[model samples]
Target chain A: MNKKIKTYYLLTAFTIFMFGFSYMLVPIYEVFCEITGLNGKTGSINSTLVIEKPVERFVRVQFTSNVINSAPFKFSPGKKEMVIQPGKIYTTFYTLTNQSNQPLLATANPSITPGKYAEYFKKIECFCFTHQQINANETKELAVQFIVDKKLPSEATSLVLAYTMFDITKQLGYKLEK
Target chain B: MNTDADHLHEDHKTGIMRWITTTNHKDIGTLYLFLSLTMFFVGGAMALIIRAELFQPGLQLVNPDFFNQMTTMHALIMIFGALMPALVGLANWQIPLMIGAPDMALPRLNNWSFWILPFALGMLGSTLFFEGGAPAAGWTLYPPLVLQGGDALPYAIFSIHLLGLSSILGAINIIATILNMRAPGMTLMKMPMFVWTWLITAFLLIAVMPVLAGAVTMLLTDRFFGTSFFTASGGGDPVMFQHIFWFFGHPEVYILILPAFGVISTIIPTFSRKKLFGYDSMVYATASIALLSFIVWAHHMFTVGMPLAGEIFFMMTTMLIAVPTGVKVFNWIATMWKGSMTFETPMLFSLAFIVLFTIGGFSGLMMAITPVDFQYHDTYFIVAHFHYVLVPGSVFAVIAAVYFWLPKWTGKMYDETLGKTHFWLTTIFVNITFFPQHFVGLAGMPRRIPDYAVQFTDFNAISTIGSFGFGIAQILFLYILYKTLKQDVTADNKVWEGAEGLEWTLPSPPPYHSFEEPPKVE
Candidate 1:
């Protein structure tokens, strides 16, 4: 009888430990994700590069775009969509634009889906890659230059680069979209 | 002290007033069973309506809102009104007898628990006629959406609070009775596994009911009091609600199934004509499963952007559960191996339960794989998984329990022919209703939608037809129950040759107040 009671108590202690452990683990994991970016950052993907190459071999493509928000936006084109041979790097003209009504108040939120490719794509000097703001109706353009890796697969064609323009003013509930 | 003849003519008149005001275990058990049966039919009818709506997918029978209400009400009714109450009814009837006590430890509390159910379910069911409608949010009552539901929300929440309170109190009563009121010679280890399982289940209820109460309270406060506890705009996370809900929710699943485990344990031994193999191991396994239940909450939330570490931890823990669960399945099969088995209706249901529940368990394991669950979550696969466990696993055990005990309770034999008919109809139709759901879910059909796209229509039609057939089949159970109550038939004191228990020591249809002096346990 005493043994039964002892076993019961031991089981009770075990159950309590498990319950507490379950509650603690969730927040701990959230912290890990925050520190490691192990699952890739949420809402953190922002650059759109359109490459247009009319002819094959080495071709030059000009990039153009309008920026309506406050952050500086830049685009680089590799070989254009029409002509790009496998294992070749073509000089592509890069364009940068900035349209902001005021200094940016909100930080850039970047995210990626199908979360398998975070290592392959690296971002630098991006308007959304970091926090920056342009003055109201301020339009500025810059060039981004890059070469498509010769080792890049032929099947890696026509990638979609998307940039969502978030309004910091509207986030604060004021109409700033001109 | 007394001879058999003197005992036979002894004044058995416990007056009408005794029944009305009684705290007697047997009386309370009778009331609970009858009430649950009534609720079962009511809930079953609601299911028929849902099936009728999905009969051909284009709103054949009811509007979308009404269809939602039917689905919601059906789940609410089955989980609370029917299955839980029925198990409690069995507990009321058997716990004392099995333990050699005269009644529950806290008898008044038992009555209160039983009586509160009707009012709670009444409040819940009456919401169908309310200005908005019955709770359309699925039984999980996930917020942000449930908050958008109007006046009926409070009624539903109030009903849930009442139900949870009743369950908590019932658990307390069971715990007290098992811990404090066993016969002098009945030690903890010697206590029936049914009693032991319920003891653990009661502990679970006491621990989690408050959490559920707190969760629903937060929901109410958020909706009415402008609390931002779950609002994304006010720095509260919507995902936090899932965390809290599943915290209480996972254990709630065990609360439904543990008693069924008890029932299966009881039936398997009786029919197999053998002592339950590894009784101590069975007890340990039940405890392990209950302990593991707490950590497994996150398995249900793999798609909610849970961190990879959290996902792996939950996945591994959830899978670890199958070890003990597999032990139980193996134990049951071994118990039955080469034993002279009979095909009585109760035994038949129990046999079916062993096979079907294992199938459910495998699917559950399949769902626990985090990557695979990403495809299965919130889809028909999930729907199929639970229904498999719930319908055959829990519901079938409840039926088997009823059949096993009916003769002992009523002192009359149920028509075996009719019972077998009911079993076959239920078994066939239940599979038909839920099996195709797997294919549809794999084909990417999400659950809780009132309508579906045309391509998925065929499987939906087959499932809906099965649902209707299963719904109508339950009327046979009702008829059998009615016939047994009205007819006269004799049952022997030892109801079955293989049956073993203190309850079997008494005359069939035990006296209104049994073991006024507690019986000695061997």
Candidate 2:
């Protein structure tokens, strides 16, 4: 009987430990995702590189934007399309307008597809790299600077880069609206 | 030690209180079985609604939201409420008797475990009337979508939490009873296959149930507390939820089926009148299957956008499960190879379980190939695959266990003719209901929708009719049970001619206590 009682406690403790471990999986996964960029995330580049005597390989880049969760914001690229050389840097701007009555905190996640081409699409600087905060009825200009790698497979002619904006005010513990 | 007096004393309570307060293993087993039966009908009705709505598509019977709610709730009720509890009921009733123990190691906890279920389920079932109706987000409760659910979400999560607690406690009791309460000479390897399978299952429940709790808890907090564990906007990845949930969810499939494996392993040999073929291998196979379950979870997520290497790895590991599973199937057939087999209702159901579950397994193998799953994922093919496994696989085994043991428990022999009628009706309609799903699914009809294209109409109509037939057959099952009890025809001590076990040594409907004194095994 005493032995049974002891086993009971041991099993209970194991259950509790697994419960806490479940929460721990979140952080562990986040670390793993960051390292692997497993969830369509691209790494940030701190130093800008200048391509001299560039390959000048022209590739058509298409720009698009979306709001996740039906967030009350109108977001779009400054230009719908551009043709640029792969080895040289280019900058494009996007317009974000807060249509709601309250200030909002948002995050923009970017994806480039033909997803395999994402490896060659380098972003030296992009507004999607950080959170964006806009006040009520505020409109903001966002910039993206990138150089598509010349080493990108020759068969690839064009790539679509899209940005998805997410409502982060509730998730990040900020109550900016009534 | 005054062990008999301590274990076998009569309960002083009467009526509802006897059920509410009784700690006896058999009484609790009865409670769990009744609860599972009730939930099975409740969930089954929801399934009928789904089938009816899909009968000819075009939203004939219910609105899409209500339809989604039925689909979602049916899975929740069946998995957590019906199938799991039924297995536990069997464990509670049979474990002590088979092991030669006086009772479960923790009897009081056993009582608490059975009682918590109704309250948890009541909270769940009442959600139909909630503002904006019940959760339509499907059973996976994948977020961003589930976060859009109405007032019922919290109640559902809380119910799952309660269910998890009940399972853990029951598992602890089973483990303790098996480890410490076995008869003088019964060793671990020498224990019945049913006991061995359940012992492995208990470890699985202990290990994975909390992981499910954690996943649902994160969902709760994400909805209420603004935690971004799965919110993509807050740098939390929604796919992470899939990884976490399936980490628990894959093992959960085994948690439901392994005990069914235990039941099937027990039944086949008795009917064949032979010692279980490859008993040592069956034990090893079950353990191997349990271990394999953990690594193959990502097979469920092959389309959730994992890398090529990850996909290949998950695919390989998933296919490897076929080895042990095939071992189990081969052993059952080998046991029945040339023995004096009697096709009693239990044996019939067990035989059907093997054939149908293997069919389900083959489909499972088809989907395990990463490329093939990309085509099959979320299609009616996937639906067909799981339902084949779950309904005929788990549910059939549960039915088999009931037909096998109902006489033992009630001390009354149910009419064998009515029993066979239920079995044939079930086996025929179950295949009718789910088999065409593979046809429609492979031909490209998606699942969880209220409407389908005109091309898929015939198969869906046939499938729905089959479901109704299956549902009606169960009413006959109930009627047979009622007649068995009401007619008062007593069963013999050794109910079957070929039966052999510590359980058979005791009288039919054994005593208030499982054993008045522990009996020696060998």
Which candidate wins on TM-score? 2
In terms of lDDT, the poorest run of 10 residues in model 1 chain B is: B4-13
- What is the per-residue lDDT of model 1 for residues B25-116, given as tens digits with 9 covering 90 to 100? 88888888888889988998887787667667566678888888888999989988998888888999999989998788778878888889
For model 2 chain A, the run of ten residues with the poorest summed lDDT: A40-49
In candidate 2, what are the lDDT values of residues B1-522, reduced to their tens digit? 565475446434778888888888998999999999999999999999999999996977799999999999999999989999999999999999899998899999999888889998888888999997888899999988998889999999999999999999999999989999999999999998889989999999999999999999999988888667887665567788899999999999999999999999999999999989999999999999999998988898888777788899999999999999999999999999998999999999999999999999999999999998999999999999999899999999999999888999989999999999999999999999999999999999999999999999999999999999999999999999899999878899888887878999988888776566679888
Candidate 2 regions exceeding 4 Å error are A44-63, A69-72, A78-93, A99-105, A112-126, A129-133, A143-161, A167-174, B1-11
What lDDT, from 0 to 1, does candidate 1 have?
Answer: 0.75
RMSD of candidate 2 to true structure, Å: 3.1
- Give per-residue lDDT, candidate 2, residue B136: 89
Top candidate, metric DockQ: 2
Which residue runs of candidate 1 sit more than 4 Å off their true CA positions?
Answer: A1-178, B1-20
* Interface Cα RMSD in Å, per prediction: 7.6, 2.1
